[model samples]
Target: MKIITYLFLISFFTLVSCQGNAQKKPKSEQFEIQKTDAEWKNQLTAQQYYVLIKEGTEKPFSSELNKIKNPGTFICAACKHPLFKTKRKFESGTGWPSFDKPIDGGVFYSADNKLGYKRNEVLCAKCGGHLGHVFNDGPPETTGKRYCLNGVAMNFIPTKK
Candidate 1:
C-alpha cells in the first residue's frame, strides 16, 4: 500500500510540473512583420485592432467573414499574409470562421491558460497577431482539428475568374 501511494505522488507531481510550464506568447520582434501599437492602430479598425493586436475576441457572429462562402483565401488583416484557403473552411456553426487547418506554416500555436485552463492559441506567423484558438473537436473526416478563429483577424479575398 505504501509503495502504491509513493508511485501515485510521483505521477501527480510529474503532471503538475508539466502543466506549470505553459507555452509563452512569442515576442513581437520574432515575427516577420513588426509594427508598433500606433501603427497597428492606424492600420486596423477598432475591432481589428482589438482582436489582432490586443488579443481580444469579437462577439460571435459579428464578422462578415463568418458568412463568406466564396472561393478564395483568408489573409491576416494586419499583414495581408495568406493564412487559410477557402477550400479548408467548414461550416462549424460556431458563429466564427472555422477551418480544418491553416495554410501551411502561415500560422503558429502557443499555449494559453488565461481561463484557468489550457488552450492552444493561434496567431499569424507573419505578424504574430492573435487570431484565436484551435481544438481537437473538429471534423474527424479531415484533419480532426477545429481552428476556431476570430473572423475580425482576417480578410477574405475572393478568387477572381
Candidate 2:
C-alpha cells in the first residue's frame, strides 16, 4: 500500500508539472499573427482568454450577440479575421451563436476530444484562436452545418450597407 501511494504521488506531480509548462510555453510559429504569451494576455479580456487561448466554452445564452439580428460580419476577436456573414447566421437554440458556415479560408479545423467524444474544433486561421465546435445538426434545408461559437471569441462588424 505504501509503495503504491508513493508511486501515485510521484506520477501526479510529474504530470502536473508537464501540463503547467505546456500552458506557459507559447507555440510562437503556430499562427500567422504570432504573439508572446504576455502579449495575448494583455490583449484579450479574461473571458476572451479563457475561450480563445484555453479552448473553453462560455455559458449558454450569456452573449448578447446570440440574439443579434443585424446586418454584419462576425470576426475573430484575436486576429480580426472575418468568419461568418450575416447571411449565414441563424438561431440554433443551443444558446451559443450559431452560423451555417464560415467565409472562405477564414477558419481551420482540428479534431478535439477533450470531452470524451470526437468533435470538430474550429479556430481562427490567422491567430489560431479557438472559436468553437462544429456539429452537423444545423438546419437541413441549408448546408446542414452548425458552427457553435463562443461569443467572447468573436466580434460583430455591422455592415454599412
Candidate 3:
C-alpha cells in the first residue's frame, strides 16, 4: 500500500513538471506587437497563417522568393519587421531560402521542441511570428549560421536604386 502511494505521487510530480516546461513560452513583454489569434488569422493568408502563427514549415523548394537576387529587404509577413537583406541571402541548396543572418535584433529566438528534437526558432521580435529555424550549417566565411526561413513568412520589398 505504501509503495502504491509513493508511485502515484512521483508520477504526478513528473507530469506537472513536463507540463510546466511545455508552457514556458516567451513573454509578450519582450515583443513590441501583440495580437490575438483572430487578428492574426484575418491579416495572414492560410499558408502565412500556418507558418507564422502555427509555427509550421512550408514545402521545401516551394518558395519563389528563394531564387530572387534583387536588392531589397525581406520583412516579416505578420508585422513588417525587416528581417533579412539581399546581400545576406545565400544558396544553401537545402530547397529553402537561407540567409546568413538577420537584421540586428530584428528577430528573436525560442526553443521549439517540435519534431521530437530541440531547435532554435526564429521569430519576429515585433510580432512574435515564427519565421523559421536557424542552423549552424552555413558558409564559414560570414556568420557561420543559416537562418532557414519560410519564404511565405516574409515579404520582399525591392529597393529602387
Candidate 4:
C-alpha cells in the first residue's frame, strides 16, 4: 500500500514539471537581424516603406482592398511574413481595412497611439513592423476584435484560381 502511494506522488510531480517546461518554451524563430533603414527602403515600395518603416497610415478607403473579395494570404509588405488571410477579412465601415484575426500570433499588442484616443496597437511580431490598431468592437459571431490594418503595410497574395 505504501509503495503504491509513493509511486502515485512521484508520477504527479514528474507530470507537473514537464508541463511547466513546455509552457516556458519560446515560440519565435531566430533570424539574422536586418539593421539598416536604407536596406529596408531598398526592399519595399514607397508606400510600404512609409507605412512599415516610418509607421505611417495610408489614407482611409483609398486602398484597392476596400472592395477585395477574393481568397488569398496577406503578408507583411516589409518582411514578406504572412499576417492575415482572406477568410478573416470583414467590413468594419471605418474606412481602413479590418480583420477578425491575425495569422496565429503574427501580431503583438502594444499601447498606441498618436491619436488622442488611447488604443491597443498591433505590430508584426517577426519584424516589429507596424500593422494597425485593434479594437473590441466587432461582429458578435466573429472574434469580437477588430484589427484595423493599414492596407499599405500589407501585400495580398491571391490564391491561384
- Highest-TM-score candidate: 3
For each candidate in turn, the TM-score is 0.83, 0.82, 0.84, 0.74
Whole-model Cα lDDT of every candidate shown, in order: 0.89, 0.88, 0.90, 0.80
Q: Tell me the spans in candidate 1 whose CA falls farther than 4 Å from its real position.
A: 1-26
CA RMSD of all predictions: 4.9, 4.3, 4.1, 13.1
Q: Lowest lDDT 10-mer window, candidate 3?
A: 18-27
Instruction: Please give the clash total of every predicted structure, in order.
Output: 0, 0, 0, 0
CA displacement after TM-score superposition, residue 65 of candidate 2 (Å): 0.8
Which pairs of residues have clashing backbones in candidate 2? Answer: none
Query: Any idea what lDDT model 1 has?
Result: 0.89
lDDT by residue for model 3 (125-144), tens = 88899999999988999999
Q: TM-score winner between 2 and 4, please give it.
A: 2
For residues 1-161, write the lDDT of model 1, one tens digit per residue: 99999999999888666645354454657798887889999999999999998899999988888878899999999999899999899989889999998998899888888665889999999999999999998999999999999998998999999
Per-residue C-alpha lDDT of model 4 across residues 1-161, encoded as one tens digit per residue = 99999999999788656544344323234432454778888888898888877778899998887777799988887777888898999999989889999899678776653553468877787776778899899777988999999998888899998
Error of 2 at 17 (Å): 15
TM-score of 4: 0.74
